[model samples]
Target chain A: MIQVGVNGYGTIGKRVADAVAAQPDMVLRGVAKRSPNHEAESAVKREYDLYAADPDRTDEFEAVGLPPAGTLSDLLADVDVVVDCCPAGVGAQNRDIYDAHDVRVVFQGGEDATVADASFTARTAFETARDADAVRVVSCNSTGLARLLAPVAESFGVETARVTLIRRGGDPAQTDRGPINDIVPDPVGLPSHHGPDVNTVLPGVDVDTAALKAPVTAMHTHSVNVTLETTPTADEVRRLLADESRLFLIPEGAGIDGAGALKEYAMDLGRPRGDLWENCLWGESVHVSGRDLYLFQNVHQEADVVPENVDAIRAMATDTAAAESMATTDQALGVGLESRLDTDTELPDSITADD
Target chain B: MIQVGVNGYGTIGKRVADAVAAQPDMVLRGVAKRSPNHEAESAVKREYDLYAADPDRTDEFEAVGLPPAGTLSDLLADVDVVVDCCPAGVGAQNRDIYDAHDVRVVFQGGEDATVADASFTARTAFETARDADAVRVVSCNSTGLARLLAPVAESFGVETARVTLIRRGGDPAQTDRGPINDIVPDPVGLPSHHGPDVNTVLPGVDVDTAALKAPVTAMHTHSVNVTLETTPTADEVRRLLADESRLFLIPEGAGIDGAGALKEYAMDLGRPRGDLWENCLWGESVHVSGRDLYLFQNVHQEADVVPENVDAIRAMATDTAAAESMATTDQALGVGLESRLDTDTELPDSITADD
Candidate 1:
């Protein structure tokens, strides 16, 4: 079994550690954190070996009744692969250490593309990172876009894709982040960084993106429109998207109108941390007019990338094929089987050119 | 002077009555209310005539120590123009009463376009309603779109316009409305009714729109993208939008990033009811890439349509030219003069084709 160490036990780090632990092919070696806090205590309670990320904070860890299993260097030396969940720029800072240890590394999306040999999402570019030393999983928005566009480009041939990302202001625990009572054009720039980020995995796909932040903490909603080279009925497009394991086509009869109801549904199903690992696309929103296709999808910022990180680690350390690796990760983590609604609820007839 | 009666004295009604009272060329005949409440008492305190909209509820008004001047019919017969500010669909119900009285009527955007003889926004199609029996002022979002596009279409010539409206869940006083912690694909349909609404005034302009609802109560923010017939530098477009009296180009240094800050700025300026009567477009957001133009603008739902109603009144009752009537309305109600910051703060050099 491949041993994995998670660096930085924060929002994403803790979740990635839990995901790695669940994977049957891998074992979670430990998690590294700079300070001793509630998360550290919880990590210890869950029987995870907690390493001190900062050598200077080792004493503080023991003083807080959470003794360190080892230093970050010791953990790095022991593990076969490390998932660097350090905050955005810090991953680049940790690169030299990872290189010296000569271990495979998986970087989260927050790091710049240059920090990794390849940018990856399992469905789109898993082979690009096959047996590579390090790979970066693109951000939630980019992952959602790449996962969506890959199939569209393959089937209908995308000519131009334009999207407006209506982003949540913060995750539930980010109390200080804001626009609490407002909507703001985040970056207020044309073709925000998300478009170029999507190109990292799926090159030659022409996509333009704009983003705004609203007073919400649930999930990011994307309003997507794509001009295709060939026309397809909305029903055909819906069937195509439904084939993807990561895309959850929300049904109308479920009455899951928005993120709140979606979360409530997930909690009602007793999902761990009420996580939704799939892209929740409103099934009824799938529409086609001539060459134009439009729909909206919700990306859970906290959880969408967790599965990608798991698949990325496998791509770097194993010779497993992309589809097989993805299937293994999906089954091990219960990635796509969350729907309890009657998805067979009749949708309106496809909007087509004849209409 | 044109005598104006306001029916449905709720959020928009009270504001319109005050605006009419402020206009030198108009008189507030009275306001109509269905039942007695604090608003009725406040109207009485302001010494304005109050009419009971529901004849059966006249006793309810008298029971609360608020006496009605007469029924809604009396107010409708006395005024030269009546502004219908009832809730959505209620305006359609009130249409027969105004028609029976043979009075000129200005209906709010809530009513269907078929309810009026002409759809109106002062800047775009003022003359469409010149001396007409009735006209409808478009909604706040449409008014903002028209006001921004009129100058743009005049200067650059719009080929196609696409907008994604990030709508506030409800006005501040609307406690019953929600998606309180979620973002919803309101309608989840392509080319929402907003595109058609804009066509009601600025016909022949190709526009497609989509909208979402966020957990905000401050204002609606729009992500606007237009393909212009000719390319222009971002600076030129910024200057063009800045010249429009009703467009408040927010400067970068002023630190107004979103609706919350914009509303706070207005309240700090002591604007009545913290109303932003202008479209708050972030000047720095004005961007041009080849033939495509992009920007973001905020529309105050409670206030943007107020000035339109005032101008629609003149459009339906008098022969004033569009420019003169808009100027008069602007001057009397202080429409365009709210900046306290040094708008002269130099912006970054334009992002142009050559850049």
Candidate 2:
């Protein structure tokens, strides 16, 4: 079994640790946290042995009625793959830590692609990451865009893709961010970093992204417009995405109103953390007027990458192909099942060809 | 002042009557309703004279503490123009009523193009509807689509347009409709009739629409993709949409999440019925890659068509020029002010042409 240690116990790290634990072929060795705070306490409560990232802060855990399993150095020695879920920039600082231990490492989106051997979106970048020493899973936006675009690229051949990401102000637990009641060009740039990040997975796909952070904290919704090399019917586009297990086409008749309702629906479905691990695509929204395909989809920022981390863990520690690893991760996580987010399968009249 | 009467005191009809009353150059003579429901009582409460759509059901008004001012035929006699906001197909049935009275008529989008002398989207079809005996305003979807497309077609020239309408199941007060948890093709076909309806206003414009009815009740969002004859930058696309009074480019700082928060924002702004009369375009969403332009925009179902109906009334009842009518209607209804929806005006680095 592959021993996976998560080197950050925040939103993504905690989930990644849980996901690694859930994988049949993997074992959650421990998770590292900088402080003995509530999250660290929760990690202890969940029975995950905690390792202090800062060796000097080992006493902080003991002071809080909890004891550290060991320093992060101990984690590096025991774990086969260390998933670095450090806050932005910190992962880069900790790069030498993993290298010194000679432990294969997996970094979350926070780290730049340069921090790893390859940027990974399991569906597209898995093969490239196999046996790689350091792999960085692309950000939520990249993962979402890559998952949806890869299928289209494989089937119809995409000429270009334009996606607008309406991002949430902060994570559900992140009370610190936002213009509160405003949207701003994130990172203050055009074709924000997300588009180029997507290219890290799909390599040469022509994609440009316009991004704005909304005031809400639910998830990021991508309004996608794709120009395909071939002019396909709407039905053809629907079947292509529907066949991909990660792209959950939200069918008509589902009581989901918007992201707000989608969250509630996930909670009602008893999803852990009300997570939408797969891309939530609107089936009825999928349209092909001619050579263009238009649709709106959402990516759960914290949870979508959990399974990718699981697959990346397997890729680093085992010889399983990306597809096989993805299938196993998906099955273990109860994903890729007939989606409850969109239950109806009937096609709209505008998409149906006149037979 | 031109005399105007509205038929069917439902969602679109009620708003049209209020819009007519708000116009300085137009007078609301009365509104007709078949049943003396709460809406008919509201007409009385708002000091709007209520007329019996069915002359034989005059007592129904008296039973609900609503006194009928007169019959619909009496309304047609007194009013110079009738805005028929009757349900779909019912406006077509009422075609004979307007013809018998020889009164110029305005029909809402529910009626087909054949129901009137010209199909109307004030921004695009006002000239064609000018002084016509009858003008049919396109559907909420058509009106929204036409308003956005006309500007693009005028400035950049559109080659083809594809729109996917994520529609609300029914109006907030419309409780009888829906699968409640289901999204269904309204007509069970591809290239929904909405695209054709848009063509009625902007004739010869190559456009096709895909439609789905979600369980939402607030507003309709259009996922739009258009191939323009000229290639433009994201900045050019933003500036183009920003300049249009009917298109409110929602910038990043506004903090509006989806239609829910958008409605709340409108209500907080003290708009009547918490309505957003203009299309809420995401400023950060406007993207231009090569010859294609993509964006996500919302058309407030009840409020968007109000000002358009006012313009149509002036187009038929008086010799007011289309531009004059639009300016007047936009001014009086507070339709086209600097949208409080998107507050920021800075350009993103991607779209900003200069370093």
Candidate 3:
């Protein structure tokens, strides 16, 4: 089994650590935390070896009754690969430490593209990271965009794409960040960085994006409009997207109105942490006007990337094919099946009394 | 001077009555109310001849120390034209009343396009309603879309348009309507009626629309992406849009992030009731990738149609040209100047010490 070490046990790290532990082909060696906080204690309680991310804070962990397995360097030495989940710029700073230990590294989307050997999204470019030393998974938004566009690009040639992201102000736990009672055009400038970042994985697929922050914490919603080389009926496109394992086509009769209902549905399904690993796209919102396609999808910022992290770990450490690896990750994590079963029952009955 | 009567003294009726009173060539003959309420009292205090909309409620007006001048039929007989500002279906029911009086009529967007002789937006298809017996202004969202697309269609031929409307749950006073903590894919259906609505004013313009309701009361924000037949630079399109009097291209230096700030800016400018008569589009969000044009604009539902109602009145009652009528309405009601004066002073000084 490939041994895995997760560094930085915050919002993303803790989820990654749990996902790593769940994968049958991988063994969770440990998780690193800088401070001896509740997450560290939770990590220890879950039987994950807790390592002190900061060498200076090693003694602090022991003082808080949560003694470290060792320093981050010690944990890195033991594991075959490490998933660095530190906040944005901090991952770039930790690159040297990862290089010194000579372990395969998986970096989150926050770092610049130059920090890794290749930018990664499993469905888009899994082979690019195969047996590579390091690869960066694109941001949640980029992953969501690339996953939906990949099949469209393959079926009907993509001429151009324009997207407007109605983003959540913050995660549920983040209280300080806001536009609490407002909608702010983040960057308020032409072509937000999302387009360029998407290019890292998608190469030459033309995309321009603008984003605004709304007073929401559930998920980020994307209003996507793409021009295709050939026109496809809305039903044909809907069927094509439904075939994607990572895209959840929300049905009409389910009565799931918004992110609030989506979250409630996930919780009701007994999903761990109420996570949504797939893009929750409204099935009815899919439409075609001539050669243009329009739809809206909600991307759960916290959980969409968890399965990707698992797939990335396999891409670097194992010689498994992309499709097989993706299947393993989806099945082991219960990605798409639960949502289908629930929404299937909620669908309307076609054969009524009159029929 | 042309005498105008306003029926239904509510959110829109009161505003239309005031706008009519401010016009250089029009006179507010009276306003009709169904019952004696605070709004009726306010209208009487402002010296507007208050008439009872429901003949049964005429005695109720005097019972509350607010006597009505006459019934709605009496006010209709006195005025040369009447602006129907009642709720959605009520205006359609009142179509026969206007026909009976033989007076020209202007209907708000809530009424269907068939309720009048022609659908109207001052910037688009003004001639279609010229000297007609009746005209209906398109909805606020349609007005904003038609106004912005008219110039774009004129300068660069529009091939197709896709828009996503981030709609407010309700107007400020509408406490009963909501998706208060949710982002609902309103209608959750393919091609929401907005695209078809725009076609009323701007026929044969290939457009598709999707909408979601956010927990906001300030305004509706639209993410517009249009494909043009000819390629134009972003600056060229910006310059073209800037020339349109009704489109307020919000400058970069002004820190108006979202609808809340836009409202605050409007109130600060001392606009009547903080009404944004112009489409407040972010100047910097104008972007061009190949032949595609993208921008974001906020539409104030309460007031964007007020000026359109005025122009519709002119279209049906006078021989004034579209441009001349729009300019008169803008000048008398102060449509676009206040925003410019305030943002001009807030702009950054480029000629600094380094220069």
- Superposition error at B53 for model 3 (Å): 45
Per-residue CA lDDT of model 3 for A1-355, tens digit only, reads: 9999999886678788888998999999999887664446557767889998889868766665678889999999998899988888788899999999999999999888888999899999899998689999899999999999999999988999999999888665444468777899997998899988888999889999998898776689999999999999999998899999999998654546678557645643446766789999998899999999999999998888888989999999989999999999999889983222222222211110000
- Computed on alpha carbons, the lDDT of every model, listed in order, comes to 0.81, 0.77, 0.81
Interface DockQ per candidate: 0.01, 0.01, 0.01
Docking class of 1: incorrect
Better of 1 and 2 by TM-score: 1
In DockQ, how does model 2 score against the reference complex? 0.01
Cα lDDT tens digits for candidate 2, A12-102: 8877877888888888999988866545655776789999888997875676566899999999999889998878778889999999999
Off by over 4 Å in 2: A337-355, B1-355
Any runs in candidate 1 off by more than 4 Å, and if so which?
Answer: A338-355, B1-355
| Chain A superposition TM-score per model | 0.95, 0.94, 0.95
- Candidate 2 chain B weakest ten by summed lDDT: B346-355
Docking class of 2: incorrect
Model 2 / residue A86 / CA error / Å: 0.8
Chain B alone: TM-score in each candidate? 0.95, 0.93, 0.94
Residue A243 deviation, candidate 3, in Å? 0.4
